[model samples]
Target chain A: MQQITTEGNQERMQRLVAVRPRLISFARLQLRDLARAEDAVQEAIEAAIEKDDTFAGRSGYETWVFGILKYKILDSLRAQRREGWWQPLDEELDEAAIDRQFQKNGRWDQEARPSDWGDPETTLHSERFWKIFDLCMTALPDTAARVFSLRELMGLSTEDICRETGLKQNNCWVILHRARLRLRACIERDWLAEEA
Target chain B: MFKMMMCKEATHLMSKRLDVPLTFQEKLSLKVHLAMCSYCTQCNQQFSLLHETGKQYEKLIERDIVTLSSGSGDSR
Candidate 1:
């Protein structure tokens, strides 16, 4: 753990204050409740400040603080689940709707054909793409969005997600599959279609 | 005919690979489908792009923190 000198403590305090807004925004993306998001961020920052010595400086301060915030968000989610305030993701994807994307023999329909996306990493620098990306992410069903965020954004594994969200393995896989399908379609329609 | 997988099923396997390990037969089936079907291949590519975009977005968010902290520091 890194030693927090008096001067370092003051600097860290200011840095934490600056990062708080971003932390709250992240929490809001997961929690979907503004007041609850704020509360989670507040608790995370307080815990970090109180446990300043626990930061080993192996990671950047912001990264370390965000790690703390991730746990806080999970705690809040678990508490919400325990209190019966959490809603399961909508899993009843319409079979007809899904089948419509395929032909009688299961080949892809013409309309369902995905075009080759050449070097998608090129678009990451585009601010407009991120805006559309954010919209597509937020438009996902609440639980689906959280699952995607935890798995993709936070880089959590499937087992970790099941543990964190109290989801069964099969259910977790189904939710992620549906979420990916929706997100890919949404981006293609709202973002990629526009750029063409 | 029994061994043949549909595009829907292939897509499901493609997505599943991201979350869990597919059995040898499952992987072989998806591979065969991708080989014969341009559409599923493109779909797989699109999913890859989404995963790439997500990782890049996280880095972008991290960079934004430096930008935020370097500014007047009072801006929320």
Candidate 2:
């Protein structure tokens, strides 16, 4: 029985190490800070190892590990919000940029109009397309990216996002709108244009 | 003179609808604008596509992690 437990622990440690990079990627996307993401993933790994004996078999090991990391990421986000680390400095600038996409008559400016992306499902399947998608996500102003991820990737409602980030409802909507515009334009320029 | 909804407002409504339900009036205006303006119509579709892509990206990462970790000899 002792030998069996020792082998199980060894296997668990190996699995944890194997999944570390993906965990870091997930954390970085959510936290947007590499060092902090690394710290959270490390802490999660340590916790998983320490609690190996008590792990309930209800969930897959990877899912269980991700659950711990998600809490860690949330803790870091709460801490950042409390510290007021992200100011809304560039929000007006973003609004101005969005306005430029339209003409004086409120029609889409010829140069800024969104083009037909013909079969976006095909693009979703392309590995290279996702690379451009990741670049576009990274290019967003930090706060916009965070709000976008919380609303879309994390599946939080607008109200919850506003509560979490201390943003007003209107402000949250504006940020999400800008994020969608920028991502659409970026993908068109980088991926769709190349295909044509 | 019938006031036509501009692409700017139409696009904002498109993005906003993804996060929250649009009021009946907002939905009617958006429907009218989209029928008249093909550009905003396309943009609206792209917004929904982007939302789906974000969801798929999340799943992709989770799938990768699961596959990597499960490569070990542990059977579950």
Candidate 3:
């Protein structure tokens, strides 16, 4: 029994090392700082190793490890919030770009109107489409990308997002709106327009 | 002329709805606008699709992590 337990621990450690890159990428998406993301993933892996005995096999090992990493990422986010590590850059410029989509009458500009994306659902299954989507996500302005990821990708509530980003509730909503609009336009232009 | 919901406002409401519950007036105006505006209606569908894409993207990340870890043979 002791020998069996030792082998299990050894296997777990190997698995942890193998999963490190994936954890780093996941953290990078949320933290948006490579060093911080690497730090968070490292901390989580260390914690996982220390607490290996407590890990029940109820879920897949990767899922369980991800749960721990999620907390580490959130803690890093909270620390950044307390430190005022980032400020929304060129916010007025971003807002102005969004406004350009509409005319003085508040209707869409002829050139800015959303085009019909025939069967967007079908694109979800296309790996190339997701590659375009990732490019569009990366193209978002810094603050807008972070806020949108927290609210949409991470499934954080708007209030939690406002607290994390030190933005007011209305500002959070506006950023999310801008992210969606930009992402929509980017995907349309890069993916759909290219196809045509 | 009565103030009607413009496409800009309608699209904003559509995107905002994905994040939060809209107020009654906001919901009503959005509904009214979407009914008359085919463009806004299409925009609404795309907004929801975008939300779904976000969820799917998360799953994809998780799946990739699992595949990467398992696909790599034991490297001590």
TM-score of each: 0.82, 0.83, 0.81
Question: Which regions in candidate 1 have their CA more than 4 angstroms from the true location?
Answer: A1-5, A93-97, B52-54, B68-76
Write down the lDDT of every candidate, Cα atoms only: 0.76, 0.79, 0.77
Interface RMSD, prediction 3 = 2.9
- The residue ranges of model 2 lying beyond 4 angstroms of the native Cα positions read A1-15, A48-56, A59-64, A88-90, B66-76
Deviation in Å, model 2, residue A176 alpha carbon: 1.2
Q: What's the lDDT of the predicted structure labeled candidate 2?
A: 0.79
Each prediction's DockQ against the real complex: 0.51, 0.58, 0.49
Candidate 3: stretches off by over 4 Å = A1-22, A82-84, A88-91, A118-121, B65-76
Residues B1-76 of candidate 3: C-alpha lDDT, one tens digit per residue: 6589889888889988988899999999999899998877777887887788646665565676566556767453
Which residue pairs collide in model 1, if any? none
Of candidates 3 and 2, the better by DockQ: 2
Give the range where candidate 2 chain A is weakest over 10 consecutive residues by summed lDDT. Answer: A85-94
